[model samples]
Target: MGRNRISGVIPSSLGNLQMLNDIDLSRNALVGSIPTSFANFGYLFSMDLSNNELNGSIPKEILNLPSLSTFFILYNNFLSRPLPQEVRFLEWVGTIDLSGNHLSGNISMSIGMCKSLEKLLKANNMFSGPIPDTLVEVKGLETLDLSSNELSDSIPPEIRNLNAL
Candidate 1:
């Protein structure tokens, strides 16, 4: 449903597409939580769930996907706590966009482990705490954004290492 004006929950039944490797539901008017059924998309390698009215927690199971990449969960009304501990492995991912939500709590140090991260856009949220020194561990991090939040701390020395950004 790319660029469709469809609003409301993505049918939980979409999870039944077990062989689907790519799903693009971006730029839609969808709302509510991403169904837990979505974790059933085991073969999904690329998913674009960005630019919607979706809310609720980021499912932990989605992070465990072995071949998944290109996650886009941006520009929505997501009201939730910090992402799960397991999502840190999303470092194996590319182009994750989780901007414009109401998520709070410390930005996980585990995110530093996502060495494959690029196009990382997380701004306009309630995320607080210091920039973790561990963030330097994400080697290919090209776009590190932590803007417009309540984040308070001295900039970590490790950030200086990202001169490439």
Candidate 2:
């Protein structure tokens, strides 16, 4: 469900839907961290939990889902802490949006391992440190928005090599 007035935490029992391919729970009043049981979704391709009251760091298992190739959107939530390094496992994911949250720490260098990533939106958070040069490895990246954060240092000159940007 999306754009609803639904409130409260997402039920962890939802994870039992092993055949699920897509789930949209955006624009709700849901609170609490993402249920780790969600890792059980073997066929999940897209998930949108954005604009909610959810908090806590993302579960690494969610990022490691091999079938999660379409997109994963968790923006505009209260989620915090460094993005899990397991993000490197999303080798076939096309887009990832973690913007408008309280997430902090250096953007993981492992992000470059997302070989099929095309759009990575991580603006308006508390992330700090220099933009990782490894980002250049995402040669298909076309929309990378790391703005409105505490990032420092100069833009990596190597980023110019991303012909898709």
Candidate 3:
């Protein structure tokens, strides 16, 4: 139910829809955390929950779904926390947008494990620390925007190796 101005917490029971492949709850007034039960979306390939008031840390269980290939949780009311190491499990994910939130901590080096990652938009958050060296390993990465974060350190020289950039 995208752009429906839907308010209130997401129902965990939605996860029981085993056949669900895509979910778009963007442009809503949803509150509360993303339900852990969402991990049950075993067939889910894409999800968008942008422009909402959803608060709390992103659930790692949702990130570990093997079929998740695209995700957009931008412009939300979520708070600060490093992305889970399990985020690397989304090897099939090609695009991810986690911008315009309060997320903090280092961008995990394990992000390099996403071999298929092509576009990563993580600007306008509270992320700090040097850009992970492992980012250079994403040979297929074409669009990477880490702007407007609190990140320190210089651009890695190895970034030149990303021919797709």
Candidate 4:
């Protein structure tokens, strides 16, 4: 269920439903780290856990959801840590929202490998450094939000070549 006032931690048993395709637990009061068992959602295509009380580093295993195409975990409780390099595994993913968290460190250049990626919302975090030149490789990207971070250096000159922006 999504957009409800539901509170408390997500149940790990939800992972047992192999046929489940999407989950939207956004705009809730849910707390605690995401259930690691969610990595078992082989059929899951989308998930939104934004605007919740969830905390802790995202489980890297959850990034392996083979069918996952959209992910949103914005405006959450104190989640922190560098996004895992395995994020490139979301080859089919088109949109991702990880803004307004406590995440720190450099944005992974490998993110440019997500061939289908279009919208990337990573504003309002602690990311620092020049935008990776490799990001220009995401030829289909339409919206990229890196505002409010500590990034420095000149804007990648190649950014002008992204016709999709």
**Largest TM-score belongs to which candidate?**
2
Question: Which regions of candidate 4 are displaced past 4 Å?
Answer: 72-75
TM-score, cand. 1 vs. native: 0.91
Error of 2 at 162 (Å): 0.4
Candidate 2 lDDT over 1-165, as tens digits, reads 999999999999999999999999999999999999899999999999999999999999888788999999999999999998999998999999999999999999999999999999999999999999999999999999999999999999999999999
Q: Could you estimate the TM-score for every candidate? A: 0.91, 0.98, 0.95, 0.94
Q: How far is candidate 2 from the true structure (C-alpha RMSD, Å)?
A: 0.7
How far residue 58's Cα lies from its native spot in candidate 1, in Å, is 1.1
Quick one: ranking by lDDT, best first?
Answer: 2, 3, 4, 1
- Order of candidate numbers by TM-score, starting with the best: 2, 3, 4, 1
Q: Report lDDT (Cα) of residue 68, candidate 1.
A: 76
- Tens-digit per-residue lDDT, 1-165, candidate 4: 778989999999988888878888888899998898988888888888898988888788988888987654455556788888888888778888898888888889988888888999888988887788888989999999999998889899998888998
Model 1, 6-114: lDDT tens digits are: 9878898998887889888888888888877777877777877877888888878777776777664555566578877886757668877778888888888888778
For candidate 4, the C-alpha RMSD (Å) to the true structure equals: 1.3
| lDDT for each candidate structure | 0.78, 0.95, 0.86, 0.85
Q: In candidate 3, which residue ranges exceed 4 Å CA deviation?
A: none
Candidate 3 TM-score, true structure as reference: 0.95
Cα lDDT for residue 14, candidate 1? 90
